[model samples]
Target: MTNSENSSGSILQWLGFRGARGGRSVDGKPAFANGAGNVFQQARRHLLDEIAAFLLTYELDVTPNNLLTAHGAFSGSNPALARKIAQHVTAGLAVTQEWLDEITAADETIDKHDGIQHLMARLETTLESFSKNANDTRSATADYTDELEQHVAELDQVQGTGQILSSLADLAKAMLERTRKLETDMRRSEEEAKALRRSLEKARREAEIDHMTGLPNRRAFEAVLEREYRDARASFDPLTVAFCDIDHFKRINDTHGHDAGDRVIRLIAEMLATISDDNCHVARHGGEEFVMLFRGISLSEAHKKLDGLREQMAERRLRNRKTDEPLGQITFSAGIADVFDFSDPRAALKAADEALYTAKQGGRNQVIIAPKGGAQAA
Candidate 1:
C-alpha cells in the first residue's frame, strides 16, 4: 500500500470505522473506495466544525490547540475544515494569552471575574467535542483541567479566610492579656493603700497615748486644756484645774522597790481615770503628780469630786505578790484653782501648786481650794 493509503486507513481506525477497498473503474482508479473515503471525510469535517464552534463560543483554548496538532496531518483533501479548525484554535490561543496578560497587568480586575467553576464550565463543554475521532481524549482533558483549577481557587480562598481568622484571634488575645494586667496592677495598688492607712492610724494612736500608764499623756492633756480655755474665754464658762500629788511617794519607792512603786502608780492612774467624767481630763503630769482639767464646773463642785477621789484611793490597798505584804494604802494631797483668775495654764498651775503645798503642810490626804484672789488654804 502507498503512504497515502496507510494514512487514510489510520484516520478511519482512529474514528473507530473500517477503511474499505473496491474494484478499479474503467479509468484504472479505485472507483468504489474513493466514494466511501469521501463519505467518511465529510463526516469527520462535520464533527470538527461542531467542536471548533463550541470551543470558540466558550473559550476553551488549550484543548483545541492540542487536537489541531494531533489530527492536522491526517485531515486530507478537506483543507477547508483543517484551516477552519486552525483559525479557531489560533483565536482561542490569542484570547488565552491576552487573558493571562490582563490578569498580570491588573490583578484587581481578576477578582471581579466570574469565579473559577463558572469559567471552567463554559470552557469544558467547548473544548471536549473538538475531534469526532478523539472525542473521549478531548473531553477527559477538559474535565481534568476544569476540576483542577477549581480546586486550586477554592484552596486559595480557604487559606485567605484562615489568615483573617488567625489575625482576629491574635488581637483578641492581646486585649485580654492587657486587661488582665490592668486588673492585677489595680489590686496591688489597693492593697498598698490599705497598708499605708493602717500604718498612719497606728502612728497617730501612739502619738496620743501615754507609754507608761496607757492614759492620755501630758501633751494630750495640754491640748484639751487649751481648747477648753478658748471656749471658756468665748462663752465666759467656768474652767478649773486640780493638781494632786501622791503622799510620801518617795518613801514608798524607797521602802518597796521601784517596781512596786510603778505598780502603785499604775493603780492610782486607773482609779483617777474611772472617777473622772467626759468633762474632766486626767493625765500623769510627772513623777507622782497628776493634773485634772474641768470645764463648766465650780470650785465647790471640784472640791467634792477631788475629796471623794482621795478617800477612794486611801481605802484601796496595793500589795506586792512576791513580798506577800501590803505595799501601802495610797493617799493624795489635792489643790484646786479657778482658771477665771489665771490668764494662762502656767498661772493656774502655779496657784494650784501653792494650794497643794498648804494641803501637804496641813497634813496629807486632803483637798485645798485657792481662795479667789487669795493664797491656797487646806
Candidate 2:
C-alpha cells in the first residue's frame, strides 16, 4: 500500500473504526470516512482546535507546572472536582501574586528607608560641621573683640567687628538649611520603616500556608505539633497523632488518571481542613497521605474523630464524566497514637505509621490504634 494508505489505516486503527475503500456517500461524493482524501487532516485540525479551547478555557498556561496541574484537574473522574481544582489553582496563583506584591513592597520600602538614612546621615554630618564652624566663628569674634580692647586703634577694631558680624550671619543661614533637611529626612525614613514592617507581617503569615491546598503545610504542622507536644507533656494532657493514607490511591491513578487521583486528594484535604480547628492541626504529608495532630484529646477521642472522617469518605461516590462510570468507593485508613502514652513523641509518629500500615493490610478502610512503646497495634 502507498504511504497515504498506510497513514489512513493507522488513523482508522487509532479511532477504532474501519472505512470502506473507494466508497461513495449518499450525495455521490467521495466518502471521507472511507480512508479517502484529507479526512485525517480535517480530523487532526478539529482535534487541535478542541485541545486549544480546553487550554484557553481553563487558563492553563503551557508551562510544566501548569500543564501538570491542568492534567490532574481534567483527567479526574468528575467535572465538578476538576472545576474545584481549577478554582483552587487560581486562588493559589492569586495568593502567590499577593506574596510577590508584598515582597516587592518590602524591597521598595527598604530602599526608600535606606535612602532616607543616607540623607539623614548627610544632614547630621553637615550639622556637626556647621556647629564646629559656628564655635570657631564665636572664638574668632571673641578674639577680635579682645584685640580691639588690647589695641585701642580706630581702623583695625572697626574692620574686625565687620568681619565677625558677617561670619555669624553666614553660620546662622547654613544651620537653618541643615536643620530643615534633617527634619525632612527623618520623617521620610519613619514612613518607609512602617511600610517595611507591614510587608514583613504578611510574609510571616504566608510562610505557614501550603501553596496547594491553602492548609498548613508539613513545616507548620511540625511547629504546632512540637509546641503542643511539649505543652501536653508538661500538663500531663493527652496528645494524639494520626497518620492517614488514601486506600488504593495508586489504583485510582492507574484507572482514571493522576488528575483524578489529585482530585481525591484535594477532596480529602478539604474535608480534613473543614473538620479541624484551633485545637487540632491537619496537614498533607506528601502524595495521598496526611497527618493530624489532636491536642488534649484521648486515644479514643482521636480514634473516633478519624473514624468519623473515614466514614464520610466512604459515603462519597465519585463518578467518571465521559463514561458515566463509577470510580468505586474512595476511602482512607488511619492510625492514631497518643503522644502521652510514649516516652518520645517521635515514637508516637512511628506507632501511627505502623497502625496505618495495619489498617491498610486489614482490609483498607478502618482506623487502627498503635499501642505505646511502638508495640503491636491495639
Candidate 3:
C-alpha cells in the first residue's frame, strides 16, 4: 500500500506477471511478484544458502570471522579473497578454518634479538671454564712438584741409611722432573686447546650467521625460537613467529643471473634489518628465505609492523647493478603465527610455514597469518 507496492507493481507489470503479493509460473510453482525487491530477496537467499553450503563443504564454523570470510568469497566483493580461494581449490587443498583465518587476517610472526646472543654468551662461558680448569691443573701440578723437591731435600738432611736416602733422593728428583715436564706439557696442550677453542668459537659464531646478509642464519633462528618461546611464556607476553620467502626468486636468478640475485637477497636482508629491534628479530632462513620473531606485541600489531616493511620493499624499483637492467618491484611473501597459540614453538613454526605456503599460492607479496584456535599469551 506504499511506494514499495507501487515499485513491485511496476516491476511485475513489466514482466507481465499479475498482482504483487501472490503469483504462479508456467510450471505451476509459487513465484515472486518478480519485483525488484523480490528479486533482491531471492538473490540474497541464494547467496546465504551458498555460504551455508560452503561452510558445510569445509566443515568451517559460522563464527564472525568465518561468516564474513565466506560472504566475501561468494559475494564477489573481495576479488583477492575469491582469487585465493580459487587457487586453493585448483591446488586441491581443503578449505580449512586455519587457512581461512590466516588469509582473511593477513599477517606475520616474531623472533627475539637476544636468543642468539644468549647462545653465544653461554658458549663463551663454557670456553672460559675450560680455559680456567686447564690453567688450574697446570698450576697445581707445578706446586706439587715444588713441595716434592722440598720433602726430598728434608729426607737428604736426615741421618738415615746412606744408600736408602740417596735412592729416595734420586727417585724424588726423577718424579719432580717428570711432574715438571707434565706441567710444561699441560701448558702447551692448554695453549693449543685455547687456540683451537678460539678457532672453533669463530667458526660457530660464523655458522650462526648468514655471510651474505650478516643476519643470523637458519640454525641461529631455531635457537632464537626456542629461547623466545620460553621467555614469552615466562613473562606471559605475546610472541609471534614468521617465515618469509622472496617471491619469484628463482625467476630472478634465471633471468638476471646469480650475481644479481645475490644483490637482491642482500637488499631484502637490509630492509628486514631496518625493522629489527629489541622486540623484533630477523634472520636469513636460507636461500631467498628469512625468519622473523616478535615479542611483547599482539598478532595484529606485529602484522602491521611487518606489513609496513613488505609494502616499503614493494614500492621500490631496483635495477641490476652490473648490467643496469631494471628488475621492477621486488617483493616477498610472509606468514605469521602466534607462538602462544600453539602448544610449542615448533608447532607454531609449522603453522607459520603452512601459512607461508598459502601466501605463495595466494599470489605472493602479501602477509598471511596462521590462526589456530585462540589462546592466551601464556
Q: Each candidate's TM vs. the true structure?
A: 0.51, 0.52, 0.52
lDDT of 2 at 164: 57
Candidate 3 regions off by >4 Å?
1-181, 373-378
Give the per-residue lDDT of model 1 (tens digit) for 1-378. Answer: 223323432432322221112223456433344455577775665445433433444354656443453244234543433343334334444424454334333433443374566678877865665555377766768857875675456445555677767755765676689889989999989999999999989887788777778887778888888898898889987889988899999988888889888887888788888866778889988888888988778878878888898999899887876687887678999888998887687788789888988899999899898866656665
Error of 2 at 107 (Å): 84
Candidate 3 vs. true structure, TM-score: 0.52
Assess the local accuracy of residue 51 in candidate 1 as a C-alpha lDDT between 0 and 100.
Answer: 38
Provide the clash count, candidate 1.
0
The deviation in Å at residue 109 for candidate 2 is 77
Candidate 1 displacement at residue 269 in angstroms: 1.4
lDDT of 3 by residue, 1-378 (tens): 223223322322322232212234455433433443766787675456556656766678889878887677667665556666666654567778888878876721111335567778999999999899989988879868876788668677767598776877777888899999999999999999999999999999998989999999989888887888888899899999988999999999998999999999999999999989978899998899999999999999988988899999999999988889999889999989998888988888888888888889888899999989532121
